[model samples]
Target: MRVYTLFTPSHKGLYEDYFLKTLPDEFELHATELFEQECPTGSFYHEGWDKICYRKVELFVAACEESMGEHFFYCDVDVQFFGNVVDLLVREIGDFDIACQDDVTAYCSGVFVCKASHTTLAMFKAMKRNYNREDQTTLNEHLHMCQHKKLSPAFFTYGRVAARPWSGERFRVPENVLLHHANFVIGVENKKQIMDYTREKNFS
Candidate 1:
């Protein structure tokens, strides 16, 4: 399996460094840097959340087309992997066209496993055409219309789980979790501090 991720200017001093350092060597990793010049024409290139989502779809579809692997996994740069995620995903994907963690309203697009097929390509195209609220929302809509596997939160923990202490919520990080995503819960500096702590605690 091949893993693909995107990085924009705002992520430069934040996620980019940690992600590049921590990404395992076992899988083929494709990291796309989204510069203003690279943004596709006819698309809003404003420096905002929507622009980031648009670039993610563009980069993801490009990676899917360029990869030779039968299966492709897309992960946000804010995610950290502790195990052989590709192996785990390949085993868990089964016969589904796509697999991801369900985030109540929709499956989180931060981490997902997709089979490289015409159907997958078409779904991505449809997602690009229907740029609504965000990439995850659009992806969820398409996923609802296709064959997909909804992974348990244990496999791909998000910010709510990672930052439970801040919200006065208690949760456990499952022993089998392969990936942890630090979503829009905290600022970049705080994220860096947490990443430093995580690296020393687990990855060292």
Candidate 2:
């Protein structure tokens, strides 16, 4: 298996200094930096998020094909890996075209595993139909049409502070999650602070 991620030029330092340090050495890791480009009207979400998201998907698919990897995992830069995620995926994601954490309303796209196949390619094509929608939403729509798996909540958790459905209290990061998604709810500086704290306390 292979792992992939995309980062912008502004966050290159974060990827090199922090995110790269958290990755296990068992699998090949690929990180690509985004380049500036003039996007066509209606081709992206606010501030080029959609374009980057689309590019990530395209690049992931190409990488899988080039490497002939059976499966590949893609994650946002804000995610920190705590364990050998590829091993966990091998044990858990059996025969699924894609696997992601369910965020109740939709599967969180921040971290996901995809199997290389015609079906996976078709799903990416379908997602391109709605470049204006959030990537998570587009992914959910296509996932529902294909064979996909949902990772257990214990394996993945969101770091964003929000109202919890179970207790109606603010959400908190659970202990020992394989992947922690520091979504855009908090600012980048605070996200880095949280990651630094977690690394020192739990990951160290």
Candidate 3:
């Protein structure tokens, strides 16, 4: 299997400084640095951000179309690795076409392992067509057709699990966290700050 991830120029620091360094040497990683001259925003849920999401969908579909592997992995640049997640994914994926991180509202498109078959190509292509909504919504719509699995949050975690220890969220900080996706907060600097502490906390 191969790994696929995308980041914009705005997030180049995260890609180079954290993501590239933490990844295990075993997997071949295809990192896409996307640039959109028109929409120069990185904050989520805004028009510029929505445009970026649309472009991200187009690229993901295109990349999956050309990939020759039997299974594919996608991770957002804001993510960090702490353990050998590849082994867990290989075992958990089993015969499923997709294995997703169960974010509170929906399946997180940020981190997932998918089969590189026509079914997945079709699913991602369908995601490309939903221009009005973000890519994750489209993923949830098409997920019903594919055989899938939801990875436990402790293993593949979200930043909220670490960022707000006082909020008393359902998911506590996992002591042996395998991966951490720095989301549920805004801006790159905020992400960097949380990731710095989260990585230090977990790595130690």
Candidate 4:
């Protein structure tokens, strides 16, 4: 099992450095930085309302294909691992395509596990071809299209998790601790504090 992440200039780096430091040395870690140079507007997308989503998904598919692992995981930089996540993932959902919950269902496509098999590749291609160019909308649509087929749910986790009095212990432990960290900027300072406290006690 390996870990993968995508980032742009806009994304901050403390969280990425933190995660790289935290993962066990045994697990392979990979990352692809998406910059304007590589994704010059015309390369990934034509300027339009859908440009952002199209560019992101297109880049993701390209990276997954080029990566040299039998299994590829798409993880958000903000998502941190507090425990031995590789062990947990192997134990629960080995060699499967796992996706995050899309839309108001909670979370974004911040994490996913792909098998890299022929069928899985086909599904990914389908995603590129049928992409609605609206992340949530396209992802949900892809999830449905891949149902019980190659693409299946490996796990769904809460997005932007941070230890807080308001969160109680519930947010700290999930039914599945596949990924945990802050996604959006709202409540970030507080989230950072909570994350720091948890890392001191739990992650390191």
Candidate 5:
């Protein structure tokens, strides 16, 4: 199986330091570094960040389409891993076209596995064709016909606020988490801080 991720110059370190370096040596890794002048660096959401988010979908779609007949895991650079989850996730792909983190309301585009079948390609193409606002919203609308699985238990996805109980937020993490995602936070530095904090708190 192949793993893919897209990042900017600011986030390239996450790919270099945590993603490629810390992860177990069990899979092939691929990354796309966006150099577009229009794309911003930070994780903060804005007009520029919106374009980065949509572009992420475009890059992911291209990677999956080119690798048809195989499975590719699209991961966000802003993450730290504690375990090799490829085998676990692959087993869940039994007959589904995709497997991803589910935050209850919508699919977390931050991390997912693409089976790259014809149906999966069509689904991705549809997202690119009918792109509006961003990727996750359009993905949820088309998922009615998508054969996908929402992953949990073995994976944990949360924001900076919830990771620290002292922040008055409930410390929301599974007892067995393969990795911790630094989503729902602004700034790449802030994300790195959260990823490091969670890894030390749980995986250390």
Candidate 6:
């Protein structure tokens, strides 16, 4: 299967390079500019990157709709898969239009899945409406819809973190799921050091 990731000019090559090193050779990586350059730079989640954030997400959802593939997995660059995700997805989930990790507390949005279909396209349009540059909110609405049967969860197996209701595991993914979100917020010098360390070790 093909794997896709959205990254901006700020992402540099380290993140993509590490991703290439981590996944199996069969999983091809496709890179694209996450958003249109013309989108206005406004107050985007206090990061001033909000305009691009919304556009990029919509772009991904739209692209997935026309793709003639078996599955489309959407991932954030700041997060990384720590286990054999393809094996996990291949072994545990199948034939789903869309799947995503449930934010039981209304928070997480690091990963999600979708199958190529027009229904998914409509859903993406709805999700994009009234978007506040806060991706989690849009995803939360979709997750809630899935919970209510307007959407189907069977088509989606939320990540292991949301499986806690059935498995009794902790909510924090670094401990419970096959992935981890390193919300690294160190100073510039420390950030550089960490990046350098990651480059040296290839932890990705």
- TM for every model, in the order presented, reads 0.80, 0.80, 0.87, 0.64, 0.88, 0.62
Top candidate by TM-score: 5
lDDT of each: 0.67, 0.65, 0.73, 0.51, 0.73, 0.49
Q: Residue-wise lDDT of candidate 1 within 14-124, one digit each (tens)?
A: 555777666788878777776653433212234366767877887767866775348888887767767666667777788888888655455778788888777778788
Q: Ranking under TM-score, best-scoring first? A: 5, 3, 1, 2, 4, 6
Clash pairs, model 3 backbone: none
TM-score of 3: 0.87
Q: What pairs collide in candidate 1?
A: none
Off by over 4 Å in 2: 37-46, 67-69, 159-172, 200-204
Model 6 over residues 70-165: C-alpha lDDT tens digits?
Answer: 666666554444455665554443655555554444434545555656666666667787575666667666644332111212212224234232
Write one digit per residue (lDDT tens) for candidate 3, span 77-166.
888888677778877788888888867666788888877788878777777665556777777887876787787765455533443322
For candidate 5, the 10 contiguous residues with the lowest summed lDDT are 159-168
Q: If candidate 6 were superposed on the true structure by all CA atoms, what would the RMSD be? A: 7.6
Per-candidate clashes, comma-separated? 0, 0, 0, 0, 0, 1
Shift of residue 147 alpha carbon in model 4, Å: 4.3
Candidate 4 backbone collisions, by pair: none
